[model samples]
Target: MIVGLLRSLSAKVPSAVPRIALTMKPQVIFVLGGPGAGKGTQCTKIVEHYGYTHLSAGDLLRYERKRPDSEFGQLIDSYIKEGRIVPVEITINLLRKAMEKTMTENENKFRFLIDGFPRNLDNFEGWTRDMDGKADVKFVLFFDCSNEVCIDRCLERGKSSGRTDDNRESLNKRLIETFLQCTRPIIEQYERQGKVRTIDASHSVDEVFNNVKKILDKEG
Candidate 1:
């Protein structure tokens, strides 16, 4: 298993870089949000500025779904469409494999920002097992945006993305159910642990990213 590892002491660290260290296992920063909450924008900035690998769980599942020959292709696809999480074992294996590949491929380069993962209590449990029960969770970034804004963004993205699931009805379902069934408690879990940071995602793209930058800076 190729486990991707990222170290902070790489030469010529960026000015905004945090003072994290190399780890046998990569540090995970989870970015949580409702659909279309500008998680992607913040993730992009995180990668560009702070040297983190952004892993979108939705994208990963979608890619898995596209491989029709795979056994769980349709099963995984169905779960995502209903704004439901895939089975814990399946998800954990996929993420672990991906992370391992990343570690080996990047020579353990950057911290990993996992977007849309640990969508439920079970997902969290599975993740703990996958991480050998002692995973390092840096923190959670919650992109707080109104449902209306999220719907608008999903609709906008759907027009060009060839993703049928991004349509109005499906997106509405996703937004409502995602918040209710998945994100809310996870947010609270992090909050209880004092690891949740809420970001106002109602602003313009650049403005939202600026807020994210400030948070990362403070944490670093």
Candidate 2:
């Protein structure tokens, strides 16, 4: 199904660029955490204050899932609703296209906050293979919030978020191992390389953002 979808997509759009294939060298910061771990909030703050284009992985998948002309719409929707990772090829392709599109539009816009990505080893490995040397990853900004808090926040937001997967039942299935199990290795790998800046995200938004600001200020 994925291959067929990719082929169908390629019939209309340009073929995906292979690894180390592009010339764009944007600055990238990966923002990762469980749902409602204050990642989205901090991303917005970063965009406003630091001028980084916030390219949320979840948002990109959601947008593609909802796009009427998208060949991968149903597949993406089903994967997301099941709390599963979308195919690595599709994700890397979208990320590259977004990077290229934005950079082509504004020559000076190169900084990007890629939020909620590399959810597992496959994601990280695929990114390394398919990002086409488009970016120099600055760091991974990890929001360290407890699972309970993250679930609670998701439930509260579901009241108004109008999202199917934000409710308690979905959050229970989706977020139980999102931080500790799914994304732990990626965080640890970056940690060993001194590329993980973890923030205590159980605090109020302002406090969390302040810590994020300090990290951003000190780091490149």
Candidate 3:
């Protein structure tokens, strides 16, 4: 059923990664928020203060989409422009390689802040199954913000962000269908696990990070 649902949403997943498990148990904190919810801004602060490697799922996807020879470039471009989630296989593969690269580059420095990932329950399921539960998730850091604020911030960012999906139509559909309809359940599931640290993100940069600082200080 999960595979069927995923196929309905995107391309058929390649079966190459039936069970590619992460060998290391890195300290990872999932940084989740809707677009323009300030996840990147706060992730920078967290990295500066905590010496953690910040791996953003959106960033990786964008990088791959622009690569001169990336196999997933066209697929990623289509999905981004249409406000559809990329197949979890491509996303998880990117994240897995990034995480492993960080681990290798820094040896014992394993603290990681994975941003803008597991956007829906399908993504969460894909991560658990593919990663084999090897990564130790410290907690999920969720940013709570209103739709108006998020849209406003995204539109402002779109002025120069150069992202394909930053336009009004794309942002509106993504926020409604993906963020509210899908991502909320991921937050609720993590909340039930007592692993969610919700931060009010409708404030000024410094104001929001001040709250994030408190949560990380306690939860990190």
lDDT per residue, candidate 1, 1-220, as tens digits?
0011112212222233222223556778899888899888789888999888888888888888788685567676777677666666665556666666677677655478889877878777667755653347889998999989998998899989888788888877777776656768878987999999899999999999888889999983
Measured against the true structure, the TM-scores of the candidates, in listed sequence, are: 0.84, 0.90, 0.90
What value of lDDT does candidate 2 attain over all alpha carbons?
Answer: 0.83
TM-score for model 3?
0.90
Give the C-alpha miss distance for residue 189 in model 2, angstroms: 1.1
lDDT of 1: 0.75
Q: Which tens-of-lDDT digit does each residue in 98-217 have in candidate 3?
A: 877777776766888999888998899988877656687888999999999999999999999888788999999889988999988998999999989999999999999999888877
lDDT of each: 0.75, 0.83, 0.84
> How many clashing residue pairs are found in candidate 1?
4
Off by over 4 Å in 2: 1-14, 17-24
Candidate 2 lDDT over 1-220, as tens digits, reads 8667757655743454433333568889999988889899989989999899989888899999999997789888887788778777778778878888888788778889999888889889988866635578999999998888998899889899899889777676667655567788899999999999999999999999999989888884
When superposed on Cα atoms, how far off is each prediction in RMSD? 9.9, 2.7, 3.7
Instruction: Say what the RMSD of model 3 is.
Output: 3.7
lDDT of 1 at 7: 28
Model 3's number of clashes is: 0
Decide which is better by lDDT, 2 or 3.
3
Better of 1 and 2 by TM-score: 2
lDDT of model 3, residue 49: 89
Using lDDT as the measure, the top candidate is 3
